[model samples]
Target: MRGRKTDGDDERLPVISIVGLGPMGVRIGHALQAVKTRYTLLGHDVDAARVRAALGAGAVDRGTWSLAEAAAEADLLFLCEPVDAVCATLAQVAPHVRPGTLITDTAPLKAPVLAAAAQWVSEGVAFIGGHPIVRWPTDGDARPDADARTPAVGDGGGSVAAPPAPDAGSAAAVARSPA
Candidate 1:
């Protein structure tokens, strides 16, 4: 979140942290890399192998096994873990997350996760419930392959899409520019 101020706006790019390096997390990392986003991607996973694989594939700028380290400076934290693990992971990272940090999840179900995240919202964190729906028809396999060239979320090709942010007035719409 460190950057020069420009016209009353912070020009610094956000530091994005992905908590789980599973298939979904990996896909998200790849998309970010493909787009050449200005943000720095910080990837983490309890499984050491997944962290190594994500780092080797260049999906993240860096990888870490420590949840606290990853969440410490993240401007945006994506909880890409499974539904059951989302709340637990949030609790573990809450202590390290800075105030005003935006946290979202890729979990399919939002009710339970959002309910569990109420504490974070009360603590001055922005909690946005996000679910990126994959539009590409899978070949009966729910997971994406390692080298798949899937489109980034919110792209017009219908590859990925996220739900509306909690604060609609503050949410910025994402549009893909001509390549």
Candidate 2:
């Protein structure tokens, strides 16, 4: 794995690549930025604007379009796209990942991801299926159907926003400022 030095700390920063810079991707990026992990975040997406938005929002350290370029030497990789896209992306990314590279995805279903991952696990690329597992409660659940607002899907492991004071059309804003 490649690493970059941080000022005052001799240890090298691990590289974390985030593929698919959509809402989930940006949310992942936002949540990552909220923490103080000493790792470089590299983001990529088929949509250039989303990548640009992630970069501009301080969610990622850098952005790229090439799957191989983004996967090379990455210590950790997060596939934050839809299920089908995640499967397709895994194939393209698996080849470039070095042994010991930990790869995971935000797909709702584990079967597909695990099935797709089977091809590369033997090669030392570890794949884990990521999911929320539990949802405590949402704005919709708390109130009557007439008043409830549907819960917005998030990056799997995080608190969901409550009712009222919603961010217009962007869930990314909600991600930037977590509950």
Candidate 3:
């Protein structure tokens, strides 16, 4: 996404909050930085050490332990947790999310998460399911290190699948429909 110009030649950047700091989340944070997107990245994790690691690695501009604080400030929220944990994390932040905040997940499975997000829709949250496919070298492989500057697509390629557009209502309502 392009940045919008503001007064005095400054640009307004988007704020993206990433709620997990594991392998996938760190990879995403690096990807965003590699693309040079002018976005303020906020990193949050239940484990404070992970947040610190992300911050130290320049994966995020800020780190927080509070889910509500992250949800309240982010224009976009990425739930980068395990499939089973996604719903619970969403519930924890649903009440704090601002209207029109776009919430998406990187969970491999969507059915369960979509089902649980319905309640969030009623609370004015916009949720969409996203899965990004990337191939990584397996252990014992002799391939060179992957370049962080480029997208991670290789012979073991996969495609991203996004669920149907969420309804204008609460997340709960959107969950009931087939994607």
Candidate 4:
């Protein structure tokens, strides 16, 4: 009798790319990798060394120089860039984002970010503002549990989900600063 083949044998995982290889960015990439095996965490930065470091550390699977390249393949794009960098990044990558893509950011502040997101909305991209209630030290070697408890999403009469959990060893336990 001939051997039977199964569809599972050739299945491939969807690639999820993360732009910006900063501290938080690396952590976001790793966090997703921790949960799913099919993830392709694409890391990028101005500095080639940072991209190398993230890949070497297993935080990201590979590196891409262009934001548009990564955005095209990402099912969900997580932006871990600084507050000031996000606006320009979005403008540059807006044309490449496919329709119905879910984009999120972890900027420190809220007001300015919300304004920036409005522009993307005009361009047909959905942006959600999330401030991970945590921050890691300059030198920490741990990651948060993939299933750690995170904040609930509130419908701001808008389309963005709540922020995700912070890095494992983040110094500021939550993304919010101590009062």
Q: Name the best candidate (by lDDT).
A: 1
lDDT of 3 by residue, 1-179 (tens): 32234347666767789899876676677667777556788889999888887787777778999988888777889998998798898778877888868888889888888887865544456787777676554553421222322334222344354543444433432112122
Q: Encode model 1's per-residue lDDT on 52-81: one tens digit a residue.
A: 888887778888888988888688888998
Residue-by-residue lDDT tens digits, candidate 2, 37-135: 678989998878877777877778889988898888478888888989988888888668888787777777767777777654445666666653323
Deviation of model 1 at 159, angstroms? 9.6
- The TM-score values for the models, in the order shown, are 0.76, 0.71, 0.74, 0.68
Clashes of 3: 9
Candidate 4 is scored at a TM of: 0.68
Best by TM-score: 1
Clashing pairs in 1: none
Q: Which stretches of candidate 3 lie over 4 Å from their true place?
A: 1-12, 140-159, 164-179
Candidate 2's clash total is 0
Q: Each prediction's Cα lDDT score?
A: 0.72, 0.67, 0.70, 0.60
